[model samples]
Target: MENHNPPQLGNQLCFPLYVIAKEITGLYRPFLDELDITYPQYLVMMVLWEKDGLTVNQIGEKLYLDSGTLTPLLKRLEAKGILIRKRKKEDERVVEIFLQQSGKDLQQKACQIPAKMQEKLNLSSEDLLELKETVQKILNKIQK
Candidate 1:
């Protein structure tokens, strides 16, 4: 007779990673709610704040989202007057996203979020940097 070992959730790396991700996002929920945006929407806003007039495909690439998922999110932001999308005049097939006055204004308020989150997490700068570096290393390996 052959003996078999059963899989255990406690032994799986994914289990803890999933829990940590959920908890971290939960920590951001209240802050994001005050900004009237979800985490994913906030990511899009951050990308635009860094550089405006990026194409739909460009935003999708940065966010790791597909057009199907990104379209509705962009539509909601457009309806909220946070941004506007326009097709390129020369290449009608390409669409670009631009931030509005409201979106630019939102950045001023969002500037405080990093400090607030750091306070909430109660982690020292060194600890936070270590965690970020570890996660980036894992992500880099996974991407390959």
Candidate 2:
């Protein structure tokens, strides 16, 4: 097969991964609309849920996002009343995110999402785990 052409569309892996991620995120759009947040905003909320009061730098680190992306996204989330942004008391230069009562309340609605996503994808848990591991391996390699 050395002389043969490389694998085409049907044999490719990355194309499907990219397409599926985009499509799946699209699926969440309507539901996310009800919450009045975009996919990136939802991601920000999830991160904040786990650890509130993180500096913009810290949130960007976990999300692989930069200030340019986080700043505007955080602003929108703040405008929606889900989060509050404030300058840190100890460091005036730093901005930290704090979840408001509305944001905390959002978790209850957000809990329904995972189950719906699973039903939509219809992938078995084992398959999902394997895919996650494979992607993690690639991320590790790329990071190193």
Candidate 3:
């Protein structure tokens, strides 16, 4: 005899992940809107905040984004005066992103976002760390 269990939304792993990602992004929207940056743009800024003067390709690699997607987001941030993309003097073909004064200032304001988001999430520190570690383990396995 053959099993007759049909696939359903409840049985799919992607469904919960999709919903969680959407909800998390939604939770960030108000805070992001205050800074006038979308979630993907925010990810780029966070990377730059940690290490400034990275090339476009470096940022793309870190964020797992393609040039087509990153280019427009970078343009928007550049237009906002948050960053400047300059051609490297030694190799003009290479463009490096440097944070502007505005971008640095924005970092100070953005620092509070994590704590606020945590408060919104309302999970214990222990629980949060465990979840993060578990997700990271899964992500590492997937990446490899």
Candidate 4:
């Protein structure tokens, strides 16, 4: 007969990953607060900053979010005058997101966040790169 032990929290890989994700997001909180945005909002802004005029569906796909979760975030940003959501004339169903001048200006301030986070983390460049690569690999495998 084979015997199996019950699962233990400490022995699970997910616990540390969950903790790390939460802690890292926590680390970004103060910085994000200064911009009057949250981590998820910052992620959305980052995507828009990289390329403007993306449809809401495109944004959701890139962020691994759904319309239900993303719609409110977009609405909030629009209310804050950071972005604008416009419906395409050709296709009313297509909602595109564009940065307002304020959003573009926000990018100037946000440019410093990465360096600040790096300083706060105190991880060597090599270590940071390795960690990012490892996480990306894991994420890729999970997605597959």
Candidate 5:
């Protein structure tokens, strides 16, 4: 068989994944705008909420971001008064982040986002679970 198909990664699964990720992020834009943050910022905030005082690198690891990205993102959060970055006294080089009162306040207003997202995705609970499991399985396999 000729297998007469395009072989570009951009034309395959990666492309849809990229698009879906971007689109979903965009779908979150309106809601996030209310908080004056972007989706990536929201992800960082969520991580900080669960674990306050995470190191910059730790946040990057969790969000799949790097210093180059985290530096600016963290700065923006700091500027927004949502987070504060400080170097450890002992290390002096390791920057850690802590969410401020405004950040915690943002949480109270964001509590409804999950419900809104559920309605937007329109996926049944079973469908959502299966999708999550499938994606996690793929991620686990790929990480190996």
Candidate 6:
């Protein structure tokens, strides 16, 4: 005989992950609000910050974001003068993103966020390392 029971939140791994993601993004809210960008937009800016002038497709790949989601985010950042999106001269079909002067300046303001967030979480360096490792393991498994 087969027993059937509905799954509960306590037994589901995804529920906790979802809640944690939401809470963490919430934690970023005030900081990001001051920067005048959402978390997703912040991610895009970070990608560009590390490497300026990346093609849209490359940015999408790095962020694991699709064009549909990335395009609007890029457009919003462009509208805010944080970034500039331009079609490649050699290939009009390809768009590249570059950090504007304002965007570059924003990076200076954004650098403090990591320390602030660490203080907010009140997690020791060791604890943070362990948590990062565990999460990366799970993420690797999911990717695999």
Q: Which predicted model would earn the best lDDT?
A: 4
Say which prediction, candidate 1 or candidate 2, comes out ahead on lDDT.
Answer: 1
Q: Provide backbone clash counts, one per model.
A: 0, 0, 0, 0, 0, 0
- Ranked by lDDT, the better of candidates 2 and 3 is 3
The window of 10 residues in a row where model 6 has the poorest summed lDDT is 1-10
Residue 78, candidate 1: alpha-carbon lDDT: 96
**Alpha carbon lDDT of each predicted model:** 0.95, 0.92, 0.93, 0.97, 0.90, 0.94
Residues 11-99, candidate 3: write the lDDT tens digits: 89889989988999999999989998999989999999999999999999999998888989999999999999999999998989999
Ranking by TM-score: 4, 6, 1, 3, 5, 2
Which pairs clash in the backbone of model 6? none
What would the TM-score be for candidate 2 when compared with the true structure? 0.89
TM-score of each: 0.94, 0.89, 0.94, 0.96, 0.91, 0.95
Encode model 1's per-residue lDDT on 1-144: one tens digit a residue: 875888799989899999988998999999989999988899999999999999999999999999999999999999999999999999999999999999999999899999998999999999999999998999999999
CA error at residue 128 for candidate 4, angstroms: 0.8
Write the residue-wise lDDT of candidate 5 on 11-130 in tens digits: 687788788888888888889898888888999989988999999999999988899988999999999999999999999989999999999999988888877877899988888789
lDDT of 2 at 24: 87
Root-mean-square deviation (CA) per prediction: 2.1, 2.3, 1.7, 1.3, 2.2, 1.5
By summed lDDT, the worst window of 10 consecutive residues in model 4 runs over 1-10
Candidate number with greatest TM-score:
4
Please identify model 4 stretches exceeding 4 Å from their true place: 1-3
Least well predicted 10-residue stretch by lDDT in candidate 2: 1-10
Q: What is the C-alpha lDDT profile of model 2 across 22-108, one tens digit per residue?
A: 998999998898888899999999999999999999999999999998999999889989899999889899999999999999988
Give every collision pair in model 3: none
Regions more than 4 Å wrong, model 1:
1-3
* lDDT of candidate 4 over 67-143, digit per residue (tens): 99999999999999999999999999999999999999999999999999999999988999999999999999999
Could you tell me how far off, in angstroms, the CA of residue 143 lies in candidate 3 after the best superposition?
1.1
